[model samples]
Target: MTPQDAQAFLDENFAPWVRALDLTFTDLGQGTATATMPITDQTTRMGDILSGQALAAMADTIMVFACFAHYGEVKPVATTNLDTVFLRPGVGTHIRCEAEVVRAGKALLFTKATMFAEPSGKAVATATATFYLA
Candidate 1:
């Protein structure tokens, strides 16, 4: 999808609260998606590092988008399980996340994501997620 279409999807489909993260879809394609989440003071923890919560949220959101790309449309999908590992403290103006689907089944979809602090290119977080696709 084009950037405008991706942005419009984010504007229309996501919850107002999820939209609060201000995620921007940078690249969208079948089985793969990339997004950037701007990091302001509100997104940081005590050390000014990106909050784990934000990273997880971004991972979850991007995986959904990855599914959209995979199927060429957004289906009614819900996150069933999500796990994230912190690799390092995030240090950057934004967090870039890339997600890809490992498997897509009749009732389930599996996706994994890697998050990095841009400009620094340091890996900060990784996530695996399961979604129930209706």
Candidate 2:
């Protein structure tokens, strides 16, 4: 799917809280998508650093969009499993999430995402996810 299409999908389908992150799709291809989520005070806890949970959520959300792009459009998909690791606190203007589909089968899909703080380009979090496609 095109980046425009992916943005439209995000606008239409994602929950309000997810949408509140103000994620913007910057690039999209057959099986990959790159998104940016700006860090705000409300999104942080106390240290002015981006929260790990927020980063994980953004990574998972980007992977779902990447899978949709791979499939040509939005199909019914559910997260079967998701694992995220927080490597460091994200302290930057924004975080970038690059998601790619590792494998796509008839009934399942495997994907991964890396979240990095821009400018510094430090890896803040990583996630692997399994989705059940319907």
Candidate 3:
């Protein structure tokens, strides 16, 4: 999928909270998606560090979009399981998310994502998720 396609997918399919993150679609190709969430006070938990919840949600959303990219269309999918690990605090202008599909079967899709704090280029979080496709 092209970046424009990815942006349209996000605009059409994501939830309000996901939209509040103000994620910008950067790249979309080869069953993968890259997006950026600009850091703001609203996105931080405390002490000017990005919230883990936001990171997790962003990762999950990216995976959903990645599935759309691969399928060449939008589809209904529910998160069956989501596992996330917070590696470090993010303090930068923005957070970058890279999501890739590990596998996609008839009933389920598996994906993973890594979130990084730009400028510093530190990995802030990682996530793996299972989505039940309908």
Candidate 4:
């Protein structure tokens, strides 16, 4: 799917809480998708760092669109497993996530995402997810 289509899908399909992040889809390539989320009160923790939950949610959301980009269309896919590792505190005005489909099987798809703190451009978190194609 194009980035426009992916953005529309995000706007229409996500929950109100998820939409509150105000994620913007920047690019959509073969088997890959990239998005950015600004750090705000809704996404910051006590230390004023970007929350892990917010990063994980963005990773999960973008990975699903990466699956759609891989398949060339939107389809039913459920996250069977999502593993996120926090590398460092995200100390920036915004965070960017790049997700790619690692493998696509008939019944399952594997994807990975790397989230970086903008300006500093440091890796803050990484996530690998498995989705069940329905």
Which one is best on lDDT? 4
Residue 77 deviation, candidate 3, in Å?
A: 1.4
Model 1 worst lDDT run, 10 consecutive residues? 1-10
RMSD of 1: 1.0
Cα lDDT tens digits, model 3, 8-96, are 76788767888999999998877788999999999998699998888988999898888887787778888999999999898999999
Clashing pairs in 1: none
Q: Arrange candidates by TM-score, descending.
A: 4, 2, 1, 3
Residue-level lDDT tens digits of model 4 in 47-105: 99998899999999999999999989998999999999999999888999999999999
- Candidate 1 lDDT over 11-125, as tens digits, reads 9978887899999988988888999999888888998888889899999999988988888876788999999999999888899999999999999999999999988988899
**Alpha carbon deviation, residue 74, candidate 4 (Å):** 0.3
Backbone steric clashes in candidate 1, count: 0
Candidate 3 is scored at a TM of 0.94
Per-residue error for 52 in candidate 4, Å, reads 0.8
Clashing pairs for model 3 are none
In the range 1-134, model 2's lDDT, one tens digit per residue, is 88888888889988999999999999988889899999899788788989877888898899999899888888888999999999989988999999999999999999999999987999999999999997
Model 4 lDDT, full chain set: 0.95
Model 4 stretches astray by more than 4 angstroms: none
Clashes per candidate, residues 3 or more apart or on different chains: 0, 0, 0, 0
Q: On lDDT, who's better, 1 or 2?
A: 2
lDDT of each: 0.90, 0.91, 0.89, 0.95
